[model samples]
Target: MDIKIIIDDKNIKTLTYDSPVLLSRVIRDSGCGFSFPCSGKGVCGKCRVRVTGCVSEADEREKKLTGENSAFRLACLTKATGDCELFLPDKNITALTDGLCSRYSHSPFGEGVGAAVDIGTTTVALYLYELENEKLLSVHSFANPQGIYGADVISRIEASLGEEKEKLRALISKGLEEGIAELCDKANINKEECKTAVVTGNAAMLSILLGEDVTGLSASPFTLADYFGKTVNINGMRTYIPRAISPFVGSDITCALISGSDIMKNEKLSLLVDIGTNGEMAIKKGDEIICCSCAAGPAFEGTGIRMGAPAREGAINRVWQERGKIKYSVIGDKAADGICGSALIDSLALFLSLKMTDETGLIKNPTVFEGQPAIEIADSGVYITQKDIRSAQLAKAAIRAGIDSLLNSCGAASEDLGRLILAGGFGSFISPENAEIIGLIPPGTAKRTVAVGNAAGMGASAILLSRQALEKSEITAKNAASLELATSDFFMKSYIDNMYFTKKD
Candidate 1:
């Protein structure tokens, strides 16, 4: 039977999909604005959808999630019986094209026109530059097409091992091609006019992009068959890829350090933490750099939370407590549709300060707030649930534990580093004060933290502009020491220790 879902919004037409599949899969296959935080495990309850058509009754997960008698159904748990009318969060749906950094200073390497692409797990940014004039010609941004598969690298690696790997690789390649074609068109040049393309990403991402097998990455002592950099010809353009440091810390981190090499020249000890599903961090002390990767999960990017969305329009990206009243700012200055990652941190801090939530992340459910384990962020009814709190706790704990592991390995404390550099989109948008309030970043590091927007993208640009920079990336990748978290007992201990909401006095 064909499944039909109708959005209750003006000018929005009904969506028809063939089914016998879970609604969550259909929603993602349809490329809608819906999210599945648990990757459709039915544990997060974030992929809720409403139906008025023929369908099986909600399952135990749905029933428990929605309080047994609720009208909405958990999309992952509910299977279709026949054609049905479905409703979506129309006003709150976000477009992925926004929140891209198109700004760049031309540092074109080689000669002629070229392009640099950063293939992030959640997003992709591309820049077209004229090497002759050192001018940045065009820029484009889009959501990583593979996001529908899952948010983190492991899900991606699993997807890459099965028959779906080809489909997955094609998705990213097509997105990159589209972005490249658009950049060429915007600059009024032909696709072949650009002679060079520099790409950077984590090992898994780069592996899939280059059509390499990912089975080795799934086991203990993760290994990459394609750790060595390669130059391939795509659409008549020579594409250059950098070597990965390890299976987890790929070339992107190398490029990030390269982009920030000037700052590191300050001759002070510092750390570069790239916040993403794969939280990659590097500790630099007098030319010696040690790095590690943590499975921070997708929670930080607004996945896995009910009423959570990406940093799209209407997403509550900011929240604060003003004289016992809660206030927030949305992504596009519209009404609160759903909370994004930044708002998640802000709400955690606010809840802790207001005593609405305890140190263990238990909601007090004060008499004034409907006696539910939730903190309402807006009058529009979008709120953070108890599971969302746990999700944040897990994500934050992984990062904090990763930091501690790095610190412990370096035999240093938080005060030893002169600067803590926060890179990537999530880190760039987050408020340091809120970050400090929740202990995501340790003490003394907050005031010295620098948010370097799109450091990986800038690093890719640097590679395109200078052969010396490209050479440095290779050397950096080879020299970088990757800490294996599995062998470290301290990581597990610190992970459990940091799981709760903590605020140092």
Candidate 2:
């Protein structure tokens, strides 16, 4: 049987199979860019694709998720029985690569080209540099293909423990290889000249990349297989993975701190929060640094929520009120297909201000969507349901509790902090005022919040350029104290207290 895969009216690949085969399997085998946000569990209904010719009928689960629309079928549930043409969604995903890097003198170790890669769970950013002169040559970024496994680290860890372990490793390895190739193409340099690469990410991410067993991260104790701070050979390329502070708090935070070192240099107390699937935050007062990780879930990144997506084209990134009506701005000015993290915060804030939702996070007089109460955002068929609100509440509460725990642990409060730095792509575009309104961050700290774009990538680039920055990352990981939030009574209390929409002093 021949299966044709199409993307944007282009015939991307043709796969041959002997018997019935899953469409997702064919796409994955073909190395095509597709997302199975639920890890092909037949849930989420995110992997929608058009199929023509012989295929299995949509099951009850697929029909319920896909609704009355018969034009598309869930890729995970649909199987190509014979010759079929499968169409995938647009592959143009937006990822943030630009970041703020603290200035440091260059003392590079390599002579040829070097690459700095930040392997984020959702996205990957690679920076290519001319090592001799310490000049940046090119940058390349892409949505992490491992997203097919699932959106959160927990999902990835679960996949790593199962039969898909080697598959997970291959996916990330291919992404990095392809990323380096693209970087070299853009820089007009020979690929062999790229002598060194500095890769930084959370501990689980690095473990999966290195093909290390992730069983330690699945249960209590959360033991890390490797606290990487050494060089390893990746596909014959000399690669360095930064040191991780804890099992949950990985090297990404360490690199982000290195890129934004000035935040700690100031005498006033400061907090750095990397808001994503895992809310890893650190508080620095003088020489003392303390950090913790909170499972914020994937709500902030637009996963697990119905009609939620990443900050891609057609995604609503901002929301406001105009003439007593909800108004929103979409990326690329495209039709709003779904809401991302920024718009989620904005919509929640607007809901509270309009009294559409109460302090308990209840939707007032909501309409029904597939039998669930939902609040319609515009007329674009995008709605936030009661369950989605709960997801957002859980995510925001986790982050809020984390901030308070870190502050209290350091014997400080939100007001006492001179600066609260927000790192990563989602952090870069969010409105701090809206964040406070939704109770995602503490009240007074919103005024002091600063979004430092892709600090992890900045730190990776710094390490590639300066040896001193690499040494600093090691020291930061060694000296930092890890706070176990799962075992903290204060975090549990604060988490429940902040679950409500109302602000509590």
Candidate 3:
């Protein structure tokens, strides 16, 4: 018999018998936005769903994480035995494309002028805009070449610790150069034609690009050589970097702050959370702006998890409730391969809400499923384990605690925030409600939140397009104060306390 499944309030076509596919796979194939961070290994537990008519066997791990509930099953673990309905949580549905890219329409330079570049730790993006009409001429993105060394900033930091520092720097520079060349090629323009360019990145990444020693920025005392605006020539492209607010906090954040200029100028309080391998935040309260960067790790970038992958094709990106059943969506409609970072965030929130995992980050009865062969022991070793959770907890805690510290420093409450801006590539994949449910962002902030896709890149482009915006970058970097979250006693204490999912009442 064909099995009918409904996802995200829509009835998907019935599946042919003998498919023997997992519920998660079915919904994902059906275009339901569901994320599986661990890539259906059943370890990350983001693909949870409720089923009726028939119940599926629960792996020891699923039972342990979620408890033995008749109504609930890990979508990745449950198999479709007959026609059924599933409900996807609202928090799991992530809109494919919001109007985030539209904000960069204004050309910084006059007509046919300027370029902006955002050198992300994982990806690099570039934009060309017409200065006169303030319209985007072209936009280009590519995987950062630094990714070959490691996926996250810390890994790159570690890679830079030894004699390979120069190599790491060259690798990143080469990637940027290639990205620039590609963008120029796509736009049918020459690199020199771009009158100006603005670059934004974390402190370590910026230091490496400029061929500066980054080791000092990684350890205690965490001192930075300089944070003021400086002009540098990269392949004849004149670039401006925002001043470093602190050792961990870099100029890219300054660019991000520049993009959210409206928030700073407004009377209302706002918080800007740029979620990445290392979560950087800036909270604006009245006239005061408090900023900090937490070493949130690379869990969101597909590193450290067994089945983790970048936000590429075959990766699950969103999830939701539909007609009493769980549904999910994957990038590019590819086969389920692995989960990316945003999916990891969603999975953690869902797992916590469903009581599959406790605040302590412990999975009660972790066991492999029969058909899910990925969970089997391999020659190298076991794949996903308790250690992965510990890593994720460390990452989540740093972000959560950082938010708490920033709020406290500004002498404001979560309710005081008038606007919350989420900036990053990974931020695009996350559901605001799931982020709130995981305690990653403040509860009410979700409603106030808007995802600004690659704001750093947009800000960099803004500077590239307009001389006025370029001058503003300098002023913004100078006035912006950076808080070193790693060295501060408050951040340290908060980090330690937030290591677990359950916060004290």
Best candidate per lDDT, number?
2
lDDT (tens digit, per residue) of candidate 2 on 1-505? 9999888899998999999999888888887767888888887878888899999988788888888757999888999999999988875775688888876678875678999998888888899999888889999989888887777888889989999899989999988988899999999988888989999999998999999989999999789989999999986789889999999999999999889645667689989999989999999998999999999998988888898999888888888899987888888867888999899999999999889999888999899998899998978778999999999999999999999999999888788998889999999899999899888888788888888888999999888888899999999999999999999999999999999987564
Ranking by TM-score: 2, 1, 3
Q: Residue-wise lDDT of candidate 1 within 1-505, one digit each (tens)?
A: 6555556654244446565667776665665544455667777666667777788887665777676688888888887777766666553432222122222344455578999888888778888989877678988877777866776777778888898898788888887888799889999999878888999888889899888888889998688898856788655678889888988898888888888533356477788898888789988878788999998888878777777777888788888877767888877767776788888999898888888899989888732322346768846577787878898999999998898888888898888878888888888888888888788988667888888878888788878877777777888888888889977898999888888878323
Per-candidate total of colliding backbone pairs: 5, 0, 41
Off by over 4 Å in 2: none
Can you give the TM-score per candidate against the true fold? 0.86, 0.97, 0.73
Task: Give the higher-lDDT candidate: 2 or 3.
Answer: 2
Rank ordering of all candidates by lDDT, starting from the highest:
2, 1, 3
lDDT of each: 0.78, 0.89, 0.67
TM-score of 1: 0.86
Instruction: Supply candidate 1's per-residue lDDT for 110.
Output: 53
lDDT of 1: 0.78
Supply candidate 2's per-residue lDDT for 337. Answer: 84
Residue 73 lDDT in candidate 1: 88
Q: Could you tell me how far off, in angstroms, the CA of residue 98 lies in candidate 3 after the best superposition?
A: 8.6
